[model samples]
Target: MAKQQLAVLITLLAFLGPAACQQQGLHICFNGWLKVPPLLSYLLCPPGSRTTNPPPSPSPNPAPPSGAGLSYDYYNNNGSSSYCPSAESLVKDAVKKAIDMDPGVGAGLIRLFFHDCFVRGCDASVLLNTTTSKDSPTDTEREGPPNKNSLRGFEVIDAAKAAIEATCPGTVSCADIVAFAARDASSLLSYGKINMKMPGGRLDGRVSFANETDQLPGPFSSLAQLQSSFREKGLSSDEMVTLSGAHSIGKAHCGFFSDRLPPNPSTMDYAFATELEVKCQGNEANMVHQDYQTAYVLDNKFYQNVRANKVLFDSDDVLKTVREVKQNAEYPEIWERKFEKAMENLGRIVDVKSRREGEIRETCWRVNGAGY
Candidate 1:
């Protein structure tokens, strides 16, 4: 009887031990699997079952796709960096020659630069860099932002570049090209030096700004508003009036200032306001598009126009309110000196990186996706 009882006890121990081992083995196996969950599996699986290890996230995303319609490869593609000074002079001369042949860009490009610099020194920061902000529009085709009626300036630059390339290839930096273009372009009217300092290597901006539209002085703004806007950019009242030299080339659509008519009219010079009302026919469609002349000529005319109450924009005409009487023939003479000095000062604004502070974007309306 004792032997039989001992045998049964050993058999029972063997059966119970195997069953406990099996249960613990399953728990250990599950724990190991939980330690390495696959990415998608972790997301899809219930809280308890997913493995922890995600296959090394596919090597971080490759660079953004080109032809994304969002980027402009100004420096790396389409042209070389600025050439030697001899080459630069060639480029500058070439651009001048082309502008001599063409109607638009040379004058427009110079005027655009002057417009930007005069307000805040020669800091091309005024040019939009859409690369990071994602604020620029796309340019997959010719229908890009430059074609927009609002961004006519980009079209002007494009024309100038095409003209320059035709005459001087790979000889100049776009920055220098633009600077010279501005000087020569402005010189077209007055036959006088623009009194410009070449801030070479000003990389064109990657994008145009829709937001800046609101910030830019409009055809109509209260004197106070105009002063505030100009002041924000470190310009004074006289300087604000002087900067209107931009009007020398650009055309104003009649509709741009139609609101200044009778009933709800914003205050403007009587003679100037009356002429616009008559010419615009209270409809923007009737306004004329006028070509801009040289800065020296442009500045002198703006002062004279304001004096005559022939200013076009509301803000322009209102210049008389502050020191209208002070702006006589003497004002124009003084204006020329100040204007030239301002132009020189404007081109000197630079950035810490020394990368021209911006890029000369192929598409002015958009930025390169690589955040160029």
Candidate 2:
């Protein structure tokens, strides 16, 4: 293992230059890639090749996992079992292109992954489409109130699925594709700061119900409600706070937080609310970002935004009261490490599929045609 690590470090140095490596042995970690300790070269990935940008390498005393789950490694877990090794790359490329055109898509994919996993596990049941023919298509998760029009980036997922299907037809699951796309978005949005190696092997689920989306937490949810919802899913308060940091790249529809508008101090900053009122004036459907600082970057800035009462949702503002959550606002690195683990936990809420219940759907928006 030492030899292999040395070889990898040599390769990294060759690319990073000896001065950068020898002068600062730790330079490799912060050279705009996710950092690994002393010699975890395998974890080092190129910016274009990965989904999230990473910071400095792990400390001697690394923080513990946010919740129990598999170790992080985008390369090893991409096509779990070698089913389609290029699955991760394909999704990453597609997401990169889409996000390049519009950074907002990256945030949308992240939210999509959360909605898919929270309701019915990370089964991609949320991707199932509504009825088409006069046959009255059965209701799917897409129709749920939380999803309906709010969920964006379906086309991005479609493009990725098409790319994967062409190369390794019927091998990669739609569920995994959604996970991969979101994973890539993290890297791109963070500009290579968060590189989460997602564990694949998920199987696309056939079932989806509009009503099931109620399982998802709401923007108006109180802290107790948020804690209860996350706890039900095996996520801790710390993990909840870490995941909420995703707001750094996220936006909300006017209706989602309009209730907190001016003259109605709903724990929101009066000035921030007024600013939103102006932007949203006469446009009921306008969208707003919570992280006014770096709306497109994925980091801990949202915690700070929460501190200033500049956030859009009650769910976000309520977090400011938590001492630990507030602390995360002060230290970006501390929250980022936890974010990686929390994301892995969210993706693995359900185990890999079985032939009886799961299959690699040919497309993401619908189940396979005809009889099994």
lDDT of each: 0.45, 0.71
lDDT of 1 by residue, 295-346 (tens): 2234466565555555555666677766633553355556666665444433
Span of 10 residues, lowest total lDDT, candidate 2: 47-56
How well is each residue in 39-60 modelled by candidate 2, as lDDT tens digits?
A: 3433342322222122223332
Candidates' TM-scores? 0.57, 0.75
Off by over 4 Å in 2: 1-82, 131-137, 263-266, 351-356, 370-372
Return the top candidate by lDDT.
2
- Model 1 lDDT at residue 132: 59
Off by over 4 Å in 1: 1-83, 86-107, 114-156, 159-176, 262-275, 289-299, 324-328, 349-372
